[model samples]
Target: MTASTSTVARTATPRGSILKQRVRWGLDHALPRTVMSYAARKGDLPGRLIVESGNVETADLVDLFDAARADGPLHRGRFSFTTASQVTVKEILTSPDFRTGIVRAGGPLAGLREWADIDILGPLSAPSLLVTEPPDHTRYRKLVTRVFTVRAVEQLRGRTEQIANDLLDKLDPSSPVDLVENYCARLPLTVITEILGVEASDQERVLTFGTAAAPSLDLGLSWHTFVGVEAALQDFDAWLTDHMDHLRAHPGDNLMSKLVAATEDGVGLNDAELKATAGLVLAAGFETTVNLLGNAIALFDKHPDQLARLRAEPGLWSNAVDEVLRIDPPVLLTGRMAVRDTTVAGMRVPEGAIVSTLLAGANRDPEVFTDPNAFDVARPNAAEHMSFSAGRHYCLGASLARMEGEVGLRVLYDRFPGLALQPGAERRPTRILRGYDKLPARLS
Candidate 1:
C-alpha cells in the first residue's frame, strides 16, 4: 500500500468503540485498588476505573522509570495522574497482548486521539512493522535494511568507543556527579550526533529537542512540557533541513550522507521524511541509551556480587547488559493500533483498540523467564530478552546500544575498581526512562 492510501485509510477509520474499550481497559486494569473496588460495588465501570490511576500510571515516562527502579518488573501505582497519559500505551505494550501481534493489527494509538496528541506523520502510523506479521514486516524491514545492518553499526564501534572514553575522561570523582548528566547522557548523545553528522555545539541542543519531541506524542499542545516539544520540532526540522541540504551539496562518509544517497526504486526520502527520520534516530539513539546506561550502573551498584562477577569475567558484559535491559528496559512500552478485532491473553479486544505491550512486564513474565526478578548475568537465555523487542519494529540501534553498554561498563570497572555509590543520590522523579538523575559515586 502506498503512504498516501494508508494515510487516507487511517484517517477515515471510525474509532468510537475502540475509544470505549480503551477507557474501559484503563479503568479495569489501570485504576487504584480502592477506586476500582468502589466502582465495582457501584457497578459504574467508567467510574470504577480512573483514566490516570496512580497505581498503574506508567503514563509518565519519569514515573515509569522511578517505578521500575523502586519496584522491579511489575509495580502498581507506577504512574500518577500526572504521568499516566504519557505511558499508558507503553504500559499496555508490556502486557501479554503485544507478544501475539493481535494488538498490532489495531493498536492503541489509533483510538488514543481523544486521550492524547499524536503526530500522524510519525512512526506511530508506520504499519506495525515492529510488531506486525511477517510478510509485511519483512517487506518494510527490507526497505530500511541498510540502515540497521550489523556491519553498518559495527563500522561505528571505534567511534562509539572513542566517545565513551572521552566522556569518561570528564568525570570528576571528587564531587557528587549526576551520571545521567555527565556520562550516561553524554556518551549516547555524542555518538548519535556523530552518526547524524551533527556538530559538537549542536549535540546538547539537538538532544534536548529530541527528548522533548518524544513525549509530545502523548503530551500534546496542552501539556506545558510540549511547549518545548513544539519548539524543538520546529528547531529540529530547520536544523535537519539545513544539514541535509549541506549533505546533498557536499556528501560525506556519515549516516546522514548515506541516507541522502540511498534510494528506493528510484524514490528517496523527501525533505520532510528525511527530517522525521533524523529526528526519530536522534531521539531513540540518544535518550534510550542514556537511560539504559544509567539503569545498568544502578543495577550493578544494587547487585555488588553481580558487578564483581562481571569484573572478574569481562565477557559477561554482554549478558549483563541484556539482563539489565530485561529487568529495566530503557523503553517501557511501545504502542500499536489494532487494525481489526483481536483477542490477547483471553481479552476480547475490538477492532481499532489501542494495544499496549508492557515490555518490562513481558520480560519479567515468570512463564517466559526463570527467576525473573533476579539479576543474573549468566542466565543462559539472557539474549532472549525482549528489551530491544522482537519482530519488525525491533530497535535499529540495538547493536550500537549494546556496544556502548559493554564498552562503557568495561571501561567503568577498569577505571574505578573501588567505585561505590555515594551516601545519598536522589533519583529523578520520572518513570518512562529509568536511571538516576544524580548518581554520585567515589571513584578510587
Candidate 2:
C-alpha cells in the first residue's frame, strides 16, 4: 500500500466498444429516465409536489438518483398540468429547502411542533434535519463541531485500521468472503461505537438500531417500523441519560462525557436535543461509511485498472474516495422545504414548497465537470464533490469518514495485495443506500 506500489500514474486506456456498451446499458436500464419522466410530468412551478405515487412500479430514491446522475445536473423544463399530477403522485420524497428561504419562513421544525407523527425521536423522523435551516442549523452544528474535528478523527485512524485488519484476519483466504458484511459494514459500526463511547458489549445492539434507522425516510412511518424505532429510541435515550449522569459524576475521554460537561457549563443540550443529536450521529456515522466502502469496492471491481492503479499509488486512496463519493454517494437526495416563493436554477418555487437538493445530479453536472461519467481520481477538483453535502447542513463527520476510508483502503491493500472480488455475491437490495449486502472477495 505504499506510494510506490500505486499504478495511478500509468495511462492504461479502456476499450471503446466496452465503454459504449456499458453506457448503452446504463441509459437503457437506468433509473434517471423514470425520475426525469416524473419531474417533467408532475412537478409544478412555484409549488412543492409531495411525491407519493407509483411506489410499486417506480424506482426508489436510490434508483432515481442513479437516473438523475445520468440526466446530468440541473434539468430545466416546463411541467404540463396533466403530467404534474400523475408524476407527482409517484414520488415519495420530502423537500428540504435548497437554501435558507424555507427556514426563514418558520421551517420544518415549526411544523414538527404541531404534529406527533413528526417523531423527532423516531427513525422516520431522520428527515428532521433536512427540514431545519439557517440560524438553528448553525447553532446546533457549532455546538457539536468539536466532536468531529480532524484531530479527533485522526485519533481513530488506528482503531479503524485495526478493525479492517481484524476483519481481514477472520476471512478464510481459500473461500469467498463477503466483504460488505465482514469488512465494510463491520468497520463503520466499530468506529461509530468507539466515538459514541458505547460499551463493546452493546455495540451490535446499537448498530442494529442504527441500520434500521437508515431507511426510515423511504419506508415512511408505518405503525410497525414506527413502534420499532420508538422502542430503540427509548433504549438509546435511557442509555445516554445514564451515560451522561456517569460523565457528570466522573468525566471521561469519550464524546458523551464532553457533551455532558458542556451541559454543565450552561451550553448543555436538553434531553430532547441530546437524544436527537446522538441519534443523528449514530445513524449517519456508520450507515454512510458502510455505503462508501461498499460502493468503492464495487467501482474497483468494475474498473480493475483503477483498482490496480490505487494499489500501486496508495496516496491516490484519498482522491479515489472522493471520486467514489461523486459517482455513488451513500445518501442520494437530501430534502429541503421552501419558505417563500423563490427561484432555484430559474424555476420559481413557492413558500412552504419542498425542494429536493439532488446531490447526485449536482455532482455529475457536465457544466461543472469534464467527462463527468468517467472516474478520474486525479481530477483537479475532485474534492469539490457534494457527497458530504454543503452549506450549513454539511456533514459534521466528513473528516472522520474520510479518515476511515483512507485507512481502511490502505490496510486492505497492504494486507492482501491480490484481493479480488468473489465470482458471485448478492448486491444489497437497496435503492437509497448504494451498497452491497454481501461483497465476496478473496485474498490470494
Candidate 3:
C-alpha cells in the first residue's frame, strides 16, 4: 500500500474499530496487578493511546525502509508529535555530530508537559543516558559503564543461558504454547530482575510496572495509557528508590549494588539520577531482549532453511542471532538531533531538528549489505547492523542482550527440534518496536 493510503486508512479507523482494537490490545499487552485488578473490577480498559502508531508493518518494513533510503540517506518526515528526519544509512548513525541531547527545557517535548502523562517523552521527565547529550550524557554514561561494562555483562552469560533453559523446560510439549508470554517474555524479565537483585516476591510487581510504562514509549498514547503510565512511573520510581536505598546499606554482587558503589569523577549518582538510571536499566534490559527472542523465533519459523542451517552448524548460533536482529530488530527506530547545522549522509540538517534514525532501515540498506532482504543466518556482515545502534549512545546492555538472544534461540531450537508455528500467532500493533505478542507454537 502507498504511504498516503496507509495514512488515510489509519486516520480513518472508526471508533468502534478502535474500541475493539483497544480491547484486544488490553488482552495482549501486559498490565500491572493494580491496573489489571482495577480494570477487572471496574470494567475500565486501559485508556486508548491516542498517538498515531507508525504505519510500517513487519512484512512492509523493508520496503518502507527502502523507500526512505531512496528518498536519500536522510529523509525528512513527521512522526506523530515530532518533526522526524530519519537517517537510513550507517554513516549517519556513526556520526558524532548527531546526538540524543536534543530535547531541552522549553523544547517541543517540554511544551507538552501538561500532557506529560501521555506525552511520555523521557527527556521531559529527567536526564537519563538515553536522552541527555554530552557532558551530562558523558557523566551519566561513564557512571553507567562502571556498572554495565563488557566484562560485567559477559559474566551474566551462564545465568542468562540457565534462565533461557529453565523457561523453555517448563513449556508443555503436547500443546501449542504462546512462545512470547511463556518463553520469550519470561526469560529476559527473569534475568534482568535477577541481575538487579529484585526480591523474588516483588519481581512480578516490577514486571507489571514495566508493562504499564511501556506504552509511553510508543509515541502515541491514549488517556488510558497516560493514566496507567503516570501511576506506573510514580510507583516504579518509588519501588526503585526503595530498592536502591536497601542496596546502599546492604551491598551485594547484584548490579544495583554496583551502581550504588559506582562513582564518576569522584562523584556518586545523586538521588534523582540514581532512580532514573536504575529505572532505565530495568525497563530497557528486558523490553528489547524479549522482542529479540520472539522476533527470532517468528523469523526462523518463516525460513525453515535458515533454521535448518543454524541447527546443523551449532557454532553458527551467534551469527544466527545477529541475522535475526538484522532481519527484525526489536527496537526499530531511535532519534538523534543535529547538534548544529550538520550534514548527515550529505543532507543538511538544521540545528535542533530531530532525525529519527531508522535502524531497521539502515540494517537493510542494499548499498551496505548484499541481498539485504534475504534472511541468511550465515551472513558474515550481519553483526554490522544498527540494531543495537552505534556511536556514543549505543545500548549499554548490548553485550548482555546479545548473549541472551544467542543462548535463548539455541536452547529453544535444541529443546524442540521439531518446533513449528501453530496457527493464530499475532504481531503487536507497533512500528518502533516490532515483535510477536503471541507466537503460538507446537513443540513436538
Query: lDDT per prediction?
Result: 0.57, 0.56, 0.67
Task: Name the Cα RMSD for model 2.
Answer: 13.7
Tell me the tens digit of each residue's lDDT in model 2 across 168-190.
88888888788887888889888
List the candidate 3 regions with Cα displacement exceeding 4 Å.
Answer: 1-56, 78-91, 94-96, 101-125
Models 1 onward score TM values of 0.72, 0.73, 0.81
Predicted structure 3: clash tally? 7
Task: Evaluate residue 295 in candidate 3 and report its C-alpha lDDT on the 0 to 100 scale.
Answer: 87
TM-score of 2: 0.73
Q: Candidate 2 — which residues are off by over 4 angstroms?
A: 1-131, 219-235, 263-266
Give the worst 10-residue stretch by lDDT in candidate 1. Answer: 1-10
Give the number of the best model, judged by lDDT.
Answer: 3
- Among these predicted structures, which one has the highest TM-score? 3
| Residue 31 error, candidate 1, Å | 16
- Per-residue CA lDDT of candidate 1, range 279-381, in tens? 6677668778887888788788889999889878888888898988888777655445445565543345555454334566556655567876678998988
User: Ranking under lDDT, best-scoring first?
Assistant: 3, 1, 2
lDDT: worst 10-residue window of model 3:
1-10
Cα error, candidate 3, residue 307 (Å): 1.3
Candidates, ranked, TM-score = 3, 2, 1
User: Per-residue CA lDDT of candidate 3, range 1-444, in tens?
Assistant: 100100000111122344444542332233323343443354221111112224334556454555555545555543211111233344555677666533343433343332222222251134566765677778888888888888987888888888878787788899888998899989888888887878779978988887766655654445576456656776776677688788788887788778877886679888777777777788788778988999898888889999888878889989889988887888876766665787665566777665666677677777778998889999989998888887777889888888989988888888899999988888776556678778888999
